[model samples]
Structures are given as structure tokens and as C-alpha cells.
Target chain A: MEEAKEGFEPKIIGFTCNWCTYAGADLAGTSRKKYPPNIRIIRLMCSGRLDPMFVLKVLLNGADGVFIGGCHPGECHYIKGNFYARRRIAALRTILKQFGLDDRVRSEWISASEGDKFARVMKEMAEDIKKLGPNPMRDKIL
Target chain B: MKGTELKQEDLEGLFKGLLDKKAVDCLVLPHKVGNNVAYMLVKDGDKIESPAASAIFAPSFGVNAANIVKGWTIPERVGIVAKPCEIRAAIELIKLKQMDKESVLLISADCSGAFTNQDYADHAGEIGDWVDSAKINELKGKGIAIREACAICENRLADVGDIIIERVDGGKVLVAGITDMGDEALSSTELSLEDKDVERQAEKEKIAADAKKEKEELPKMSSVEELEEFLRDCIACKNCRDMCPVCYCKECFFEQPLGKPVGGDLLNLAELRSAIGVPTNQLLYHLTRIYHVCTTCVGCGACEDACPKDIPLTRLYPLIAKKVQEIFEYVPGEDAEEPLPFITYEEEELEDKLR
Candidate 1:
């Protein structure tokens, strides 16, 4: 009985773009779609708008993982904003990895029509986060 | 440092002589902006005028002067008056290939310190009139003279300048040559160089010691949430960008047409906020800014000074810049020969990342 400890459940923070990912999540809800409930969605207007600091902030505050869902490249309502976001977050990921804190951060392309895709991504991300355990940023070593 | 023992008239006479002979194309000097003095380039033999003492210490003056002279392809050699930070910033700019230092002259004054605009307004008693070095020194002994950035800075003497006119040794300014260019300029002037290296070193140590104390006390937010909360007061004013000497982007990301407003859901509002004039990706903008210039940042404290909300943007940049520089073992402005991080990579050095 002592050897049988319960498995861990990861807390994932999803930053969803309002034009696509956020609408996808809303559609998933209205369609009564079933998905992992671990993801807590915070809707932003565009993926480009996410401050790389917010991900670090969320990770430090207690989220095990962060998911940034945005419109596909070239599909942004504001033209090249998502491209800029990609370039920015890509650099941020490199910087975090250099600091030994990159694995917990993830990004995906999702559209307003991709309700099922959103569900699958969330479920998979939750599993990966659970396997990865708590965010290393919480370790206080940095 | 609290009093002006030498009058501006004496300084003007010395500077006028240098300018008349075309000793330098311009003396990047100070002029009265209302009551306060900001940096202004005075061409050959022009009368120097100011209501108050200005910050000639900033390194941007060096860059601005260089940019003006070089960008315009002017044939004349220019002289610049700068603070220690300005000297450092200019040095960084040169290293980044953003500027060429061949035709510019640097003249740095003794830096007691500089006060924030607000500090000057609150303590100096009015903003409409010019506030100069004498007024600042009057408040120095009371621990209310300089800006927080100036207080925390370790460099008092302009390290990269050609000539340094410093007030040392019982208020007597000793003009000395820091480079060959300095020697050439001083060769023309009658100002004597006293062997006061010992005294100058002592002054330097005093500044370094004070800076060390402040540097140690700089807070690093333990949690991401705390950092966010600290930045929550950001009204998204681009004061930090405008005041940044190195943020020389022709057009910024936030100002571009591609930037979008954050979602209505995030604001917890009824509808999406309109996008015009609002900074859509505040964090991204800052990150991109730091990424572009992290190694070149001179920690001028101007960005923080310009912030209406007092977000301590300057404090954060230095911390991040230092980290980036250390990871790459790069000091931004130390020399011209050093290469930037993104421009070069070695297989042996990048093995960890590849694996």
C-alpha cells in the first residue's frame, strides 16, 4: 500500500488567441465536446500579443505547463502579427532553454474551426506536462 | 562638488578658443531648454548658453554626434561632451557597428550625478527654469541631488572619451588625455594636467563602492507572478522606448499595422478593445527590444526616467543584459574587435544545445 502512490496531475495554462484558439475553445464548449479539463484558458487578442514574460510568470506562479495557441502563420487578422510572435517566442524558448527552463513551454497552431484539434492538443499537452512534472522554474535554483 | 568655483565665462573662453581654430567641428554642449539644460551641439565658436546644467554625461551624445557627422557624411571632426553612461553607450554603439568613431571628439566633464526630472521638479522647486550643476551640487550633500540611475552607476569618469575635464583635488578640474584624440585636443588647450591619478582613483572607488551597495540590493522577483504584478502598473506608454539610446529601430513593432489588441475575454469586457495606439504585445515588445540590444545596452537609466509610471524598466534591462552578456562572455562596449552573439557560433560552444 505504501508503494502505490497516486500519479501526478499537471496544471496547464493555455493562452488562446481571441480570433482563433479562444473561439475554438468556446466552440468546443458549446458543442459539448469532451477533453482534458486540466487546461485553464486565458484568451488574448492575438498570439503575437503574448509577453514571453507571462509564460515565465505563469510557470513561476505554479503552472506546470504553458500552451500558446495562435492562428496559423499568414492567417492572422492583423497580417504579420503572428509571424512576429513566432519569431519572438522562438527566441524566448531558446533563451529559456539556455537557462535550463524551456521544456515546460509549448506552442501550437490552432484555428477557430479546430475544436477537435484543440481538444486533442490539450489532452496531449496535459499528459506531457504530467510526465514532465512541475515547472523547473518553481525549484528556486535560478 | 556642491559649488561652482569656476564660472561658465572661464569655460566659455576655453571652449571658444578650441572651436575657433576648427580644433573640432562641433562641441556637443548644453543649451537652455526652457529652464533645464539638455544636450545641444554648438558649432564652431558659437556662444554657449544654458539656464541650468545639462546631462553631458550620457553616451548617446557620443552616438548622436557620430550619427549626425557620419550619416550626413560630413568631413569635419566633431567633439562631444558626455557623461560616463553616455560614454559607455557610445562605446557600445561603436562595437555594434551602428556607429563609426573615427571623426568624432569626446569631451567629458566631472560627473557628480544627475537628478530625475521629477526629482528636480520636487526638490529644485520649479520646472520652468533651467537647473544646472551648481543647483544639483547644492542638493548633493543632502542626498537629494541625483537620479536613482546616476546614484547606482559605478562609472563617474567617461571611460571611452578622448579627453576628460574632471573637477577633482579640492574642486580644481584636471584636464587629462584618455586617448590619442584627447592628447591632440588638449595639446591645443592651455589647461594643465595635474598628476592626480591617486585622487581620481579615490573618487572612482567612492562611486564604485556606492554602486556596489545599490547593485547588491536590486530585487529579483522570486516568482513569475510577482514580476507580472510588478509590471501590472505599466500603462504601456512607450517612454522606455523613446528614452532608450540604443532602441534605434526606424519603426517599432507596436506601432506597425500588424499589432492587434488583446482579446475582450482577457479584459473580461463586453467587447474587444480597439487596437489603434495601444501596445498589443507589451511583453513581446520588451523582449524583442532586449533581444536586439541586450548586449549593447548601456544601462543609461533614461528609459526608467521617462516612464510615467516609474516601472523600473532600467533596472530590469541591466539585470537581463548582464545575464545575456555573461552567457556569451561578452561585454557590450569594451572593445571594437569583439563579435556579437547572434552573428557567430562555434560547434564546441553549441554542443550542449545540439545534444
Candidate 2:
């Protein structure tokens, strides 16, 4: 592992659900919450729409971290969308462990009212990614 | 319940009895037609001969037989003899509602393993009227091997069959009635049966365990680069999807115009990304298919068998599917009555799968 260069900022991609996590991030902004701006948030209508390939593509393309945010279980706006997403995430995590990038991926349930929690999570994730240094995939020759 | 002990040569007699007693109006079995052995629909008991018996114990169009049975909805019961994997496949198709179960009598035979069609021809110069297990084993061990899928097969004993013919001590075979339908079918014949449980289970488990360990130790493609390189030889012929028994979609999602890009779409996609692969969605195609078949795939290795490029699709798709199956604690085709993993959901299930 290499040390993070001075003033080095990690690039993180977050797939957030429009109904919950997206609003939570919005709330965090209005609340004057301070958090790392490393993540480039991609808003989807439902967390279930976050295909496993999206995470895989970003990770393979050298994204330092890939975070997925959705509604809590049984509280999905689409009734059962979050449940399906949960299953897919579990399978993906197990698969990524074998790829040596399981630590690079994480998912959480953030309600719209949990602005403080959202800001805290982003800060924590950004720090974790910084310590992890640049994604090794960025240096691959393939 | 007890079972009848019979000579290996008496399988043909059993089939004849099933047909003669009207247990089944039509019997679907593997028969030698000219040079190629295939599963044929036989109505006449007289036509059930030596080749059918040999082909039953040996692998002969068994998976395809499952697919064939899946399409048929007959009023008269048809007796179909398939190997363990083939029987499991049929049970899956039935669960998918593609096949009607009441119209067919599922018969399974304990299989040591069988060679592929081409391998049998190349290796066994003469597959005589009597297909001997000792001879097959000798050929299987010498240079030429069984099909990769067959070699690593976990379930060679028919676990879902109503009637089973298994190997016993001293070159004898046990033809037993496992279910009510099986016992009734057995009672129709003059062949005496003792309702004893079949042996060879321990042996089958050992073989399966050894195969599973070997498969686990095989090199797997983890990174996207490795997967792309692993599938580099693929010409996108889709012979794998076509031959897969679990892939029963009448209009495949990939085959629709959506997956194939038109001229403008191709140019736009390429321009957006600066550059793109010519045959787009090659990776997407494989991933979507493996995901779709994760719950239903029986690991029969039919896809690899059908691959013209020899992509080792079983190694790629079914292995991942097997992992997914484990996460759900769902074994495809283990029980026909059990619902598919994807369609059914538990409220608090997959708790560990999510954050």
C-alpha cells in the first residue's frame, strides 16, 4: 500500500436513491453540514435500479470507492425494491472479496431526515478511501 | 420398502412391461438409430430393445430429453428414463410450469458417468448390445476423459425420480419403486421386488465431494479484465444460451432488437465514450444471462458443451450461479415443489446481504 500524496483527494462514486438518500444529501447541504466533496452522486429513481454492473464499472475504471445508499428494508418506496437490492449487494460484496476490492464497496440505508448521518457517513467513507490510497486498478495495463 | 434385484440385462424387460401394461402409452428413451444414439418416442413395446437399456444407463441425449418432455402435454402418461442431472432438469422445468408432470412417469438410473456423443464414438470403437460399466470405466480412465461437466457432476443418482434402477453387489441392479406411482408401476410387472433401501449413496457422496473440491480449487477469473480475457475467444454465437435447459425463454431478452445496436446507436455510443468495442454488450450479455440463471441453473454444463469456441461457460456461469444459490440456501431442482429463489422473498431474509 502507498501513502496518500500530499493534498491527494480520492474519487468516490455514490449511487443514491431519489426518494431517500438523495433527499438526505440535499438536507445535509441546507443544514450547512460539512463533509468531503469527493463523492460524485448519481441519483436513481430507486435503489433497486442500481445494477451491480454500475458499481463494477466504476471500480474497474479506478474509482477509489463505490457507495450505495437506499431506503431501509421494508420501507422501500417501491414496496420490495430495496429488498432485491439488498440481495444483489450481498452477492456483489461476496464476489468483490474474491476480486480483492470488497473493502472498496459499501451500502447503507439513509432516510431523508437523517441529514447528519448522511454527512457523517460521507466524511467517514472519504477518510477510509484516502487511507486506502489510489485504486490499484488505476495502474493496471489491461 | 424393498426393491427387486435383477440382472443389468433386464432393463429392456422393465421398459417393455411399462409399455405392455399400459403404464405409459409412449416411452421416451435413448435408442440407437443408425449410427447416432438419441432419445426416441417409442409406442410399441416390441421396439424397446438392447440399445435403449444401454443408452439409459449411459449418457445419451438425457438433457435434451428433459427439454423435450418440458414441451409435451399429453393425456396419456409417457415414461421417460433420464440420468440424475436430466431428471433434475425436468423437475426444474416442471416447477417453471413449462412441463406438465402428471402426464409423465419419471424414471431415473444410477449413472457412473457417460461420455459425450463424440467422445463415445472416438473412444469406444464398438458400444455393443451390452453396455458394460467395467468397459466404460476403463475407457473413462484411459487418456480420453468424460465430458468436463460429466466428470465433475455432483448428483449422478436420480434424486427426484419416481422409479430408480441402481447398481448393487455382484454385478446386479436394483429396480425399486420409491413412490406410490413407482410401486404401482412395479406391481404391474411379474418381477418380484423387495422394498429395501438402495445402497451406493455413500459412494455417490464421496464422488460428489471430491468433484466439488476439485472445482473449488480451479482458477477463477475475478477481475473484469480477467473475465474479458477469459471470454476473449467467444464469437457471441450464443450456442450456450440456446442449449441451456434452464434458459427456457421463448423470446430471449438478449435476442430482442434492444441488445443489438443500429448504425446511429453504435456511432453515438462510440462517440460518447470516445471508443467502444465493436460487438457491444458482450460482457453485459454474459452477466445478465448468468444472473438470470443463478437460481435455476442445474450446473449441467450444457452451455459449455454447445459452445463452438469452447469457452468453458460452465466454469464461468454455473460456478457463479452456484455461489448465488448458496447465499439463498436454495439448490435448484432439489425439489420440484420448492419455489424459485428469485420469485419468492422473505421479509427479514438476506439480512446479512444488505448493510
Candidate 3:
């Protein structure tokens, strides 16, 4: 973890839905395609299951950026779950800003077969969050 | 109208008449108990009494009653006796697809006042199976019957009810229809409703002015620690959760099988710092609940009334909810078709990025 945290190296916590984004991530590994090492993935059944506090908790726990990838619209195994997740992420982004931690939070839609796009999105998000620097909550780390 | 007093018999007879005549399935009405008002279910408008013991209030009651009717094959048409706040809550719930208004009816009445749970207990001394409105009105002219939230509330007349049973004069009440269903329902009732346009206008104006003032004074904690201190006794009793109308999850995440309890039981510093399986983080629990139900919070103040520890959760939830809506422009329960705040986005949903 320390080696991965060298100067200007962003620690991105990615919450990917198992049905789509998670599968896409797995396929990326199987295909021998390399992506940024800074991205750490936690697979959830549905993006709708991701709670707003979980984002805050991750940021407060020291991640420089938090990325949420879910199934494309109307493609969720749990129909309309991605739609709900979309609204939740939009609301979460606003709350993050109120706490002055908005730049580090990002959300997008990805399908099960978009491994190449997933890699590119992660790389782009990591570069954007790197410009924002380390999370402020890191100072309070006990 | 002056305070002449409303009897239990009067309300019961009025509501029963509505149900007997196929006017409504249920009435979302408040019953007076020991000087406090409680919103409860009036089955077919019979056995009319205060549902103070039923901690859930209007906004939740509307959706709950709607769900109950939907489940039962009978009562294809149901009615909800609600307050203004409940009507607003029902609107949000309807928008969220949590409720179906097709089989439901709304019979809203003027809410004059009510009492907090603590105040009701203090007043209901010794003789207590449950108190009703007649005894409460007996203390009239002495200022003994008033809820803290009600006293501050300006939205006395509900704008959303199909039929509004308003206290018009000292000697009579007006059962008027604000909607087409209300008009049809009222047309069926034998009670006469004249066009009292002036009286209705005055009452509505007074309420609007009062609501403006009330909105200005919405309660909010100055800091994060202040909120933490206010919610100190939450302890995950789930009273607020149960009372809330919009928290409709069959099983909450906090109550999940894998979700272990955290905090409480250890005394040592190391154990205290690292206590596992303790139901701690009251703030996290509340924040999650607020996020889940923010769009649907109707500000009915039921959660605070139901809390055994008197956490003032009603005030806090609404405060946070207002902030969420302001930041996101997403009002829960307003329009069923409008996407939920967290579910959809606009071109400039992140307009604040510029700020």
C-alpha cells in the first residue's frame, strides 16, 4: 500500500456492481490488460446497494478518490437499480461538496463487457483526483 | 371560528357518515387524547378515537393505509384521514411508487393543535386506558391543549385532501371538496356545504403567512458535534425508523444478518476505542435513514413524538432533508414521475462545481 502511495499517486476506491462493472473488471484481468495499480475494487451486488455514508467513510478512511461504476441504464439485473443508484450518487456528490470533499467523488455507468472503457475511465478518474491531491481527512488519521 | 370545542361523538358521527354512504374507505383523522393529538387508522370510519398510541403520523399513515388497502382485495376504494404534512408525505410516496392513490382516498381536516408525548403523559394522570378528545377539550380556554409543533405550524388546512372537513363556524363544520373526487364524495353526503368563499380565502391566507414564518425558523444544529450530542441516546432503538412513513424497506441494512453490533459493554480505554459488535455510530445510522427518506420527509413531526428517549429526531431529519433538497433540488414525494435525487441527473446537476 505504501509503495502504491508514492508522491502524486492517487489511491482510488472503486465500488463496482457485480453484474456489470465487476464482471468487466474481472475480464480486464483475464485479458491481461494492465490498468493503474492505484485502483482498489470492492464488488457489490448492485450499485443501488451503495450507501452515501459508505462514500464518506471511504474518503474519511484515506482514499484520495472514490469511484462508483454500475450497470448501464436498463441493463441492471435488478431492473431500475441503476436508476436509483444514479439519483443516490447525484445526491451524494452534493453532500460531499457541503463537506468540502466533492472533487474526490465520481460516478459513472459501465456494462459487463466494457473492460477497455472501464480501464480508461479509471485512469481518467485517477488523473482528475490526482489534481485534487490527498483527502483532507487524512490529517485526522489516528 | 371561536373555540366552542369538538366532541368525539361529533367527529365519529361525521366520519362514519362518510364511510356508510360509500364516500371513503378510511379517514386519516386525529383523535384527542389527554390534550394531545394522535394520527391513527379509522377502519371504515368506525370506533373513532385518538391513535396517539400509534406513533406514526399523517405522511406515513397515508402510505401505510394505502399499502394495507392494496394488500386486501376488499375496500377497492380506501380513504386516508390526514393532516397537511401527511398529504405532502403521501405526495412524495406516490412519486416514489411506494403508494398507489387509485384505491386510496384523502379526507383532510383542519389541524388546530396537538400535544407532544411527554406533555400528554403528564396530563393523563391516574386514569389511563387511553384518553380521547372530549376530555382534552374540557380544559379549553385554559390553553391546556396544544402541541409544540402544532402551535408553530401554520398549515392548518390541507390543500391535497379530496374532501376537507374544516371547522367553519362555532356551531358548525364545513365538509367541502377541493378535488373532483372530493366534490363527488361531498355531493353524496347529506350535509349542506354553501359557497363560503370569503371564509376559505381568509383561512388559507392566514395559514400561508404563518407557514412563511415557520419556515424561517426551521431548527438546525450549528455544528456536527452539536448534532452528535443531540442524538446521543439514539442507541438504534429504531423507534424513529418504525415511525417514519417513507422508510419502507422490508429489512434495513443495519438489521442485516452480517451487520454486527458495535460499541457499549467495555470500560477500558483500549476496549472502548476498539469496541466491536456494539450498536454505536448513532450519527451514521441517522444519516443513512435521512438519506433513504429525505425525498419523502413531510415534516409531520411523528418521529420525535414516537421516540422514547425524546431525541427530537423530527426536527433533525427535516433539517437535514431541507439541506439535501436545497443542494440537489430533489423533493421527495412531490411528483411520482420526477426522478429520485440519487437516481437521475440533468446536464448541470453538478453546477456547483463552478462554485
Candidate 4:
């Protein structure tokens, strides 16, 4: 019943691979790119290490959205980490679709050199999540 | 392609011959225990008796026998007779390194569906007589139905087993060897083996098609609120995880210290959310479990049967598993050589699934 759409800032949990997205985020910050300061980044060695449970935990714990960033296909620093991550995130999204939360999570291939793309993705996700309103789980006692 | 047709009574002799000939050091099979039938490890040929050995063909299922045979590391070679689903679960376990494929022989049969444990125990006498006649259709006509999982089960025939027993028309049991080890074991028995074609594909397809239709007709949970509603009565006993044959973790993640919230953490969580469920993380527990098993789940419905609250879990897990499996074009327990979806991936695939 919270219909007030004035100045609602979505809280997003970003899981970024250290070799790619994490570096890209640092680059964005150094570049002073104007992206929403809504996301909290957790750097992992590889995207494959992002267990689906972690995303579920944060979402249920009241994070409004989740962002997953990894190396582009065939470009994982560990050879095939991003490939596995893609499969896992895809499967996770399929499960989330059943709960009407699929749109609340996003996965992208943002490399270390794509600071602009990384910042752009953050801004776009923040805007999209704002339009989606607060995550229903935010107020839920689940 | 060696097969032999024999009466139901002849099955006991064939199994006993395996023990007498030392084809197997032990036989893991279903036997009548007091009033209920349970899986037993029989070491001697004399221990294999009539009506008891026939319990394998009975429409009574208590647990997935794969759970019983998991982690068997003895030097003795064992032959395990089980339903098709149980065999499939065992195959998944073997692929997961939870069970050793070389250490045991997998014997599976054409399952004619099965009743839940309570139903089987209540009608054990009548069901026993019906099973002896090898007329499975008669039980349905008499208004005794199989469990929903069994009824919707498409993998009724064992395709991946080393040995397969087919119950054909006229109470005739046709035992065949599909693998090299299976042939060697069959050769030791006195029953003469000949080449025979098992033309059950059409029947199997029909059953699968019917099951698909039935599944499509069941109502689905489309949102988190609906899912929570469906699991409203769950007491968080974790029986479903315990009953699940593929949930083979030595220490489940939910049981770990990190998964448990202390009193202070609970208070903080309640304060943050303004309120919290008493059991706490009921949704998290089920979601994490379903996600964990989505890829490798055999859709055996053991979790549903284990639920004390009578939540229709079969409606959720198996259906979700079916969709997820379809996305990857992977069937759990179908092939040993196929890599697990989570462990292996292709460079250019599932593009539509990503943002």
C-alpha cells in the first residue's frame, strides 16, 4: 500500500568478479562517472563462485535488487568461470520468474575496460528497479 | 539381448541362483518385514523366499532404495533390485560420486505405479494378493489408486539399469540382461536366455503423454505470495531434505552454523522487518533446497511424501525441475557421461536466459 513514488532509492547487491566487473567498477569510480550510488558491490574471484543461495539470501534479507557482473563469454580469467556463471544465473532467473522476482535480478558481461558500460548498467538498473517499486520482500516477514 | 520368460514364482529361484552361483556376494531387495515390506540385504540363497522376493513387483513404495544403497563401499559385490525412479536416483548419485557404480549391480523393473506408505500398509493384504496375480490394472478398478507421483511418473520402465525385469501379459516375468555384467549374472541362472524384443515403447510414450497432460492441468504458483501460501503449513522439519535421495550432502548447508541465526540476529531481523516468522527463513529454506536440487532432481516425490503437513510439494519441485531441465535439455539420471549442468557449460548457449 506504499503508493508514494517520490524519491524512492532502490538498494541493490552487486556480485562482481574480481578480474572483470570489480575492476570495471573501480575504473568507473576513478573516472567519476555519474551513476546512482545505490549498489553495494561484493567482489568475488570468479563469477562461478556466486552461489544462487547468496542471491536468494540477500533478496529475502530485504535487498531490493541484485546485480551480477562477470567476464564476457569465452573471456573468463579462469577459462570458463563466466560460462558456468551464465548457466547458474539463467537457472536462478528461471526459478525467480516463478516468484515474480525475475526482473529484480540482472546479469551482464562487463569487462575491466568497460567502465562506461558498467556505470550505464548501474544507472539503468537503478531506474528500472525504481519503476518496479520496492521489492515486495522488503516489507515481507519471510 | 538375452531374455527369459518365467512365472512370478520363478523370480525367487533366479535371484537365489545368483547367490548360489556367487554371482553377487549379497542381494539388496524388498522383503516382508513383520507386516510392512522393506529393503533387506540377503546374504544367503535360502533367505530369498516366494511372495517376499515378489515384493519388488508390488505396488508398495516406502522409500527410494537408492538412499539405502548410497555410500556402500564394501568389498562384496551387491545386486540391488529397485524401482525405475530409485535406479535413476542411484545413477545420479553415482554421477555425483556419492555412490560407486562399479561396486553394485542395478536391477530395475517395469513399475506399475505404487501407493503411499500409509495406503500400502492399510491395504497390504489385498494388495499382496493383487501383486501375486500380476494384474496391476485390477487394483485401479477396485478403487485403490497409486500415489500422484507414481501416477504421473513417466519413467516407469528402467532404461539405464544393468538388468531389467519386465512383467508381460499372462503373469509372465521376462528378465533380461542389458549390460555385460548383467549377462554374466543371467548366464549363471538355469533359465535359458534367448533374444526377445521388448515392445513397451508405445505404452511408455502413452503413459508419458498422459502424465504430461495431468501435470499441465494442475494449478501452478505464479508468485512469491502464492508459493508462501502453498507452503503455509510447513513446520520446517526438514523431512523433505532428509527423504530426498539426491540431497546427499554429508553436512547439509541448512545444518551448518552459518545458516542458523542466533537470538540477537533474530531480534535484529525482526526489528528490521518489523516482524519475522517464528521458524524464520521458511521460504529461504525451501527456495535454497529447490534451487540446489533443480538440476539433478529425479522428480521422485520423496520430499512430498515426507512432508508431515501434507503440502503439495510434488506440484512445485518436480514441475520446476521439469522446466529447468527442459531449459538445459538435460534429464537427471539419464546418462552417466553427460556432465552436470552446474559443473560444465558451453561458451555460446542460453543467450535468451541472460539479460
In the range A24-79, model 3's lDDT, one tens digit per residue, is 88877788778788899999999988877788667755688888888877788898
- Which ten residues in a row are the worst by lDDT in model 4 chain A? A1-10
Query: Across residues B131-238, which tens digit of lDDT does each residue of candidate 2 receive?
Result: 344655666567655556666667777666678877666657788877777778888877787758655668778878967875776688766567778878877778
Model 1 global lDDT (CA atoms, 0 to 1)? 0.60
B181-289: candidate 4 lDDT, tens digit per residue: 8888899876799997888888889879977876777787877889888989998889999999889888887777567676888788778878888787789999898
Ranking by TM-score: 4, 2, 3, 1
- Tell me the spans in candidate 4 whose CA falls farther than 4 Å from its real position: A1-7, B33-36, B52-54, B124-145, B263-274
RMSD of each: 10.9, 3.9, 8.2, 3.0
State candidate 4's DockQ. 0.69
In terms of TM-score, which candidate is stronger, 2 or 3?
Answer: 2
Q: Backbone clash tally for model 4?
A: 0
**lDDT for B53 (candidate 1):** 33
Note the residue pairs that clash in candidate 4: none
In model 4, how large is the Cα lDDT of residue B123?
80
DockQ of 2: 0.33
Checking candidate 2 for backbone clashes, the offending pairs are B1-B195, B1-B196, B2-B194, B2-B195, B2-B196, B3-B194, B3-B195
Q: What is the TM-score of each candidate against the true structure?
A: 0.62, 0.84, 0.65, 0.92
Return the DockQ of model 3. 0.15
Better of 2 and 3 by DockQ: 2
Judged by DockQ cut-offs, the docking class of candidate 2 is: acceptable
Best candidate, TM-score-wise?
A: 4
Q: What's the TM-score of chain A alone for every prediction?
A: 0.88, 0.93, 0.90, 0.95
